[model samples]
Target: MSESILSISDNSEVILHFDLKLSDGSAVDSTRVNKKPAKMVMGDGSLTKNFEDCLRGLGAGDKKTFEISANEAFGMPNPDNIYHIDRSKFAADTELSDGMIMGFSQPDGSELPGIIRAVAGQSVTVDFNHPLAGQDVIFDVEIIEVR
Candidate 1:
């Protein structure tokens, strides 16, 4: 008797390698480049629903590519995530520059990463949106194991 293959489904533990790229074909991230494969559980809150949908029904050794929209990937940027803070809030020695990423503390003691959008003499504009927000992306995936 032949053994049945395990495919990705809800609650399945998956190990895979993936490369993320912008729609223009610029590389953004890659597990293969990092020399580590990514492992995750399906239906975990970590993955976007659309991204999980693309992984469904795939067995080990499956190789595929998927294109996801901005809304489906990192999501569209929310204007409310932008904040302007007084320059005095930062340490005097901290060099503020456009496109710098800084971690800010939240009331719950968690850290939120914010990107510096603008730095004025008295005010600094920070955007809390994910860096890839508002951009469509492509994902190249190789399923290594599913259990």
Candidate 2:
């Protein structure tokens, strides 16, 4: 009998190799670096609904590559998400660097990530949008084995 592709109800384990890249052909993440496989349940929310839809019927030893737009991938970046904060909030010894991801707590006791944009006297500009928010991404997937 031929191997069956993974389905929503399949409880078999699966190992997959994946590479995430930006529209500019820059590598964001890849499983090859650590030489390890990533496994996850089919119906779990670990992967986005759209991403999971693409893998609905792939069998073991199958390799597939696909691209997802900004909206489907990481969603469009919102300009309103950017904010400016007083420089004093940062400690004097703290070093400010562009493109650094920092976490800030909100009044609701939730923490949000922001990127350091710029720094001026007594003022710090930060962007809370995700780094890949506005960019399309490509996903390379290889299904090693599916139980």
Candidate 3:
């Protein structure tokens, strides 16, 4: 008797290695290279609904490459997500530089990460957009297990 293909389903938990690259073929992220295969449960909201849709029919040992639009991946950058903070509010000893990502506490006590975009004399601009925002991405996934 032959075993079933063990396809993915809404009740499944999948373990896989995923590599993400830009349209230019420049790799943005890779679990294979990092040696960190990820575990994702369907309907858990860990992966976007569209991203999960791509994994829905694959079986264990399957490897496929697919393209994900920016909206389906990290999403488009929002100008409203950017904010300017007063340099004086930061610690005197704190080092602030452009392109630096730092965690900030919101008034609601939530921890939000913002990337430094500009450092003027007193105003520091921070962007909360995901680094991959507004980019078409390639996803190469190798399914290790689907249970």
Candidate 4:
């Protein structure tokens, strides 16, 4: 008797390594950075629907690279996500600059990161959009095992 391979489906546990890159070929994120592969169950809200869709029919040892549109990946940035906070809200001795990422506490007791856009006189412009929110990306995945 021959053994059948398991394909990825809803609730299937998947272990894989992936490289996320910008459309221009710049690296965004990779699971191999620390030699740790990502493990997750499909439809567990850990991955976007589009991303899971790409792996639906793949089984163990499958290698594939696919492109994901910005809308399907992180989605487009929303202007409402940007906010201007009074400089007084920060510490008196705090120094602010453009391109700095700072964590802000949310009402739910979680920290949300925002990027500094500008430090105008008495107001600080912060953008809360995901850094890669507006860009398309390429996903290179190597499926290690599926169960």
Candidate 5:
């Protein structure tokens, strides 16, 4: 039987160090800061299909680096994601600081997370788009071990 390193077969565990960066070379996230490896099972939806596809055919102790565009990463931003709300919706104690994340509950009991983008008289603009939306990113992966 031929065995593969990062195959998504049953009973396989994958551990690796990952770094995410922008096209400008600015680091977005890296496992190096925490000095910890991220472990996951193959075929799990935790990672996007494009990312998982890159892990195929790798064995333990194997390391690889690849880059994915914004479409494959956080995806392109949608204009419909922007919304404006009345300032009264927020409490007086609420600090309307830009770049702050806040959660709003829908009538169906689902929660939507939005970032405070701007504040104006009696109105606040919130954006529910992903922070990295519309920007290309690079992902570096180092496969530590696979079982």
Candidate 6:
């Protein structure tokens, strides 16, 4: 008798390597580059439902590429996500430069990355939108295991 193969499903645990790229062919991220595979449980909220759907129905050793719209991948950027912070809030030793990314702690103690857009005398404009927001993504996946 032959053994049955395990296919990806909503209840399955999966280990895979993936690459994220932009429309310009720029590489955003890739586990294969790091030589580290990722593990996740389906419906575990680690990934967007739409993105997870792309992994469904695949078995171990399966490789595929998928594309998702900007909204589906990182969502559209919101103007409100940008803020103007007082330069005085930063420590004197801290460097403040336009186009530099810095972390700001929220009330919940979570850190959010903000990109500095402008640095006026007292007011510094920072954008909190994710860098990948409003950009479409190409995802390449290699399924190492599905159980």
Indicate which candidate wins on TM-score. Answer: 1
How far in Å is the alpha carbon of 123 misplaced in model 4?
Answer: 1.0
What are the lDDT figures for the candidates, one per model?
0.95, 0.83, 0.92, 0.95, 0.83, 0.92
Per-residue error (Å), model 6, residue 56: 1.3
Q: After superposition, which runs of candidate 1 have C-alpha atoms over 4 Å from their true positions?
A: none
Candidate 3 backbone clash number? 0
Query: TM-score for all predictions?
Result: 0.96, 0.84, 0.92, 0.94, 0.83, 0.92
Q: List where candidate 2 sits over 4 angstroms from the true fold.
A: 1-13, 106-111
- Tens-digit lDDT track for model 6 on 7-68? 99987999999999998889999998879999999999978898899998999999999988
Q: Candidate 2 has what TM-score? A: 0.84
Per-residue C-alpha lDDT of model 5 across residues 118-145, encoded as one tens digit per residue: 9999889999998888888788888888
**Cα distance off (Å), candidate 4, residue 145:** 0.7
Clashing pairs in 6: none
Alpha-carbon RMSD, candidate 4: 1.2
Q: Write the residue-wise lDDT of candidate 3 on 1-147 in tens digits.
A: 998888988979999999989989999888888698999899998888888899999999999999999998889999999999999989999999999999999899999899999999999999999988899999999999988
Residue pairs in candidate 1 whose N, alpha carbon or C atoms collide under 3 angstroms: none
User: Per-residue lDDT of 9-117 in model 4, one digit per residue for the tens?
Assistant: 9899999999999999999899999999999999999888999999998999999999999999989999999999999999999889999998999999999999999
Better of 1 and 2 by lDDT: 1
**TM-score: which is higher, 2 or 4?**
4
lDDT of 2 by residue, 23-107 (tens): 7889999989999988988666677777777766777777888899999988898989988889889888989888888888899
lDDT-wise, the better of 5 and 6 is 6
* Candidate 6 regions with alpha-carbon error over 4 angstroms: none
Model 1: per-residue Cα lDDT over 56-136, one tens digit each:
999999999999999999999999999999999999999999999989999999999999999978999999999999999
Q: Where is model 5 more than 4 Å wrong at Cα?
A: 1-12, 106-111
